[model samples]
Target: MTTWLLYGATGYTGKLIAQEAVERGMRPLLAGRSKEKVQPLAEELGLAFRIFELNSQTAEHLEDIDLVLHCAGPFEKTSKPMIHACLKAGVHYLDITGEISVFEYTHSLHEEALQKNIILCSGVGFDVIPTDCTALKLKQALPDAVELALGFDSDSGISPGTMKTMVEGLGGGNTVRKEGQLTDAAIGKHQRLIDFGRGKKSAMAIPWGDVATAYYTTGIPNISAWIPTPKAAIYAARLLNAASPLLSSEKVKQPLLKWVEQGVEGPNQEQRARSAAYIWGQAANADGVIKTCRINTANVYDLTVYGALEVTQRLLTGDYPSGSWTPAALFGPDLLESLPGSGRFEIDSFYPGNAN
Candidate 1:
C-alpha cells in the first residue's frame, strides 16, 4: 500500500488536503501534535491515524511512510521538528511554507536529504506556486529577466489560520535576496497601490518568502513581492512591523496567534467567492530596453489548496523531486497550465510602444 503521512491533519488547510486524499481513495496516516485532534479527522475521512509529537520515537515511527504532506503551517512551530523526523524516516517531505526563514532553513536540509535520497519541498502553496509558475512562464517569452514583481490581492475571506501564518511572517524576521546574496530586509520597506483588475488598492512590499523561490527558480537578479490588502490590514500590519522589536517575545506572538485565530468566522458563501493575484515581470535583455508582462489570478487561498494538493498527489504517484527543492525548480512553467484559468491565472504580455 502507498501509505502517506498527513502531518497537521487536523489544521484548517490540513483537513482540506486530507479530505482530498481520502476522496482519492488513499488513506494517509494522519499525524499531529495532538492525537485527539488527528484521530477523528482520520476516522471521518476513513484514514488511519498516528500521533507524532516530534519526538524521537515518533520520528522513527514515521519511517517507512511513502510521503508526508507537511501542512501544519505557521511552520515556525511545527515544520523543523517534523522535517527532522521525516528526514530520519527517509520519507519525502513537502509543506506550504510561505516564510523565507523556513524555506532557507529547509534548504539547509536539502543537501542532507539528497545524500540520503529523500525529497523535501516547501511553498507548494499559493505563496510561490503562482509567483514561481508565472515567473517561469515569463521566462519562456523573454529569455532573460532583470526583475519580477508580483502583486496579489484578495477580496475573498482568509482563513484565520492563513492570517496567523501572515502575522507570523510579518512578526517573524524579514528577508530579501540582494546582490546575489541572501540578506535581511526591513518589513514594509516597499509599498504602493495595486490594481487587481476589479479595482485599485494599497500594496505593500510585505516581504513574502517568495523572494527566495524567485531567486532560486528564475535566475532573475532583482525580485520583489507585494500583497494588496485592505487599508485596515495595512495599518495592523504596519503596527506589527513597527513593533517587530517586541514580536520576538513568544508572550507577544502567542497572544497574537490567539487573536488571529479568534478572527476566523469562516469564509462566507460570497466570502469564499473569488480573489486573485497579479505578477508583473520586467525584463532587460542584452540591450537596455524594458519589457513587461502581467500575471494575474483569482481566488488565491483556494489556489493554495489546489497547488498544494497537486503537489501532494504527485508525491503519492512517485512523481516528484528526489530531494530538498523549491516548487519552481521542481515543477517549472508547467504549474501555470495546472491552475484553473479564467479565474485562477492570467498572463498578459506588454512592451513599450515604439521600442521595437
Candidate 2:
C-alpha cells in the first residue's frame, strides 16, 4: 500500500509533499523531530503522525513502512542517519535534495543500495529534473553530443526554506566536472548575460550538482548552464560573489547566511512580487551540429512542489524506473519534450552550430 514516511512534514515544502501524499489516497507516516510541529497538519489532513529524531534508533520506526519520502532537506545534515535507519531496516528510500555535497555523499552509497535493492534518488525537485529532462532531450535530438550548455530561467518565487538553503550555499566553493575532471568555482563569480524572453538578464555559475551527474550520465565532454537573473541582479551577485570569499571566512559565513535567509523571508512586498527561474540547454557532436532550447519556470519554490508531485506520483504508481538515480537520468528526454508549452516561459530549441 506504499506506506511511505513523510519526513520533515512541518516545513514549507514538506507541507506540500504531505498534501500530495494524502491526495494519492495514502496515509503516510508523517514525521519530524517534534510531534508538535507535524501534529497540527496531520490532523488537518486526517493523517497519523510519528516523531523521528535525527539519530535515534529506527528499528521500531521502519517496522512496516515500505518506503520513505524525505522531504526534509539541506540534506547534508539529515540524510545520513535517516539513510542509516532505512538501510538497516531494508526499506526503500527517496528524497529531494539539490546540494552537490549531499548528492556526492549519497552517490557514494550507490553500491550499498544496489546490494540491498533499495532505491535512492536525490534532487526530485527543480534542482535537476527539468534541466536533466532538457539535456536528455537534446542528446536524443543530436545523436552524438560532444559539448553542452544548459541554462535555467524561471519566473518562480522561492519560499523561506529554499532561500535558507540557497543562503547556506553562499560563498562556498562548488565543483563541476569538466572533461571528466573536477573544477571548483565560487557561487557567483562566473557570471554571464542571458536572454529569458522577459528581458536580457545575467546568471551566475553556482555548483548545481547536475553538471557532475549529467556529465557522468550523458558522456558530454564540455558542459555549463547559466542560471537566470536580471542584468542588474546579476552584477549585484557578481559583486557579492567577489566579496563571498572574504565573507565566507569560517567565522562569518553563518551570520551572512542567516542575514540572507531573513531577506528571503522578509523581502519588501516588491521584492517578493517578482521572482522566476529559467532553463536553457545546448548540445552538439564532432560535426558541430548543435541543438539549443529553453525551459521556463515562473516560480522557483513552487515548482519544487509541482515537480515533486509529478515525481512522487511516478514513484507511487511505479511510473519511474527502479534505481538509485538523479532527476535527469530518470525523467529523460521524451517526457521533457512532452511538457506543455505555457505563456510564462517556453522550452523550445533551434539548431545552427554547424553554420558558424
Candidate 3:
C-alpha cells in the first residue's frame, strides 16, 4: 500500500506519466502549484489532489505519501525546494531531470537521504536510463576502459516543458568529462558521424546527464554524450556560441522564451507510437581496446513512461539502498532487458586495436 505523490502533475510529460500510472491501476495523489490545474486531472483520474508551491511548506503536503515523483522542471529552480521538502518529510524522491546540475545537486544529498533512510533517484526516464544502462554494459565489456562516448537519436517531438528547459541554458556551452572532471566546451565543438545501426547521422556533443551519471556509475574518467542533429543546426549552434553574450542576455532570451511558449505540447499518441530511439556507446582503454554497442528502444516519450513507472514500482517493493542513484547503478545493465521491444547489439568488429 505504498501511496505516492506526483508533483507537477499537470504538465505535458506529467500528464502522460499520470495516465500511465492510472492505467496500471496505481493511484497517485496529484499535486501542483495550481489547484485549478491539478484538480481537474485528479477528478478525471479519481485520485486525490493537493496544491502547494514548492518551498519549505511542501513537506506539509506529503503527510500520507511514501514517495514523490517530481515532474516539475527546469529543476534548477524547483528541485532543491522539493528535495529539501522530501528530506524533511523522510520520503523517497525521484525525478526525470536530465540537467547535469540537478543530478549533481541531488547526488550531494546522498548522505542526508541515507541518514533519513530514503532513496533519492533521478533521471529515471529517457534522459539517462537507456544511455546509462548502455554505458554500464560497455564498461562490463571493457572493464579497464579509460574513455567512454555515448550518443542517442530520437524521433520524438519536443514538449513545451523540454523546450523551455533547453532555452534556459541556451548559451551555457557544452560539457564533457576529462580525467574525471567536468569541463565546459563550446557548443558544436565536437561533432561525429555516429551510426546507430540505422544509418550515419551528424551528432554533436551536449552537456548530457550521462557525463555526470556515468562517472559515478562506472568510474569512467573521460566521457562524452551526443545527440543527433542536422548539419545546419550544428552550424547554428556554433554561431550561437560565438554570439552567446548577446544571445544569452535577458533582452534576447525573453523573446525566445515567448516563442517557445507557442510551441506544441509534445508528441501525440500517434506520433509517439510511430517514433523510435537509438543509442550508441563506445568504451576504450589506453591500450586501444574498445567495445561498442547499440541499443534500439521504442519511442522516447513512451520509454520515459515505462522507465519511470518501472523505477517507481521497484521503489514500492522496498529494500533499495538509500542514496542518489542513476538507473544502471541501482538496477544494473540488464535492466533494459525488461523493456519490451528494447534490443541491444554488441558490434563484434569493435575490439582490441580496431580504433574505428
Q: In order, how many clashes per candidate?
A: 4, 23, 0
Give the Å error, residue 161, model 3: 0.7
Which clashing pairs does model 3 show? Answer: none
Please report the candidate that would top lDDT against the real structure: 3
TM-score of each: 0.86, 0.83, 0.96
Model 3 stretches astray by more than 4 angstroms: 345-349, 352-356
Q: Rank the candidates by TM-score, best first.
A: 3, 1, 2
Candidate with more favorable, higher lDDT: 1 or 2: 1
lDDT for residue 96 in candidate 1, whole number 0-100: 84
Rank order (by lDDT, best first)? 3, 1, 2
User: Where in model 1 is the C-alpha error above 4 Å?
Assistant: 169-174, 229-242, 261-263, 268-270, 276-288, 295-298, 318-321, 341-356
Summarize candidate 1's per-residue lDDT along 152-238 as a digit string, tens digits.
655666776777876665455446566556666666566677664555677767567667777777777766777676677666665
lDDT of 2: 0.68
Candidate 2 weakest lDDT stretch, 10 residues: 337-346
Best by TM-score: 3
Q: What are the per-residue Cα lDDT tens digits for candidate 2 across 9-98?
A: 888778876786677675778899888788899999998889878785964787788787787767878888887787777776777777
lDDT of 3 by residue, 1-356 (tens): 78999898998889999999999998888999898899999999999988889877888888778999999888888999999999999999999889999988988888999999988888988888999999999888888999999988878899888888888887899999999999999998899898876889888999999999999899999999988888899998898888888867888777878988775579899998888888898888888777778889988888888888889988998578997888899999887768765886565335554545
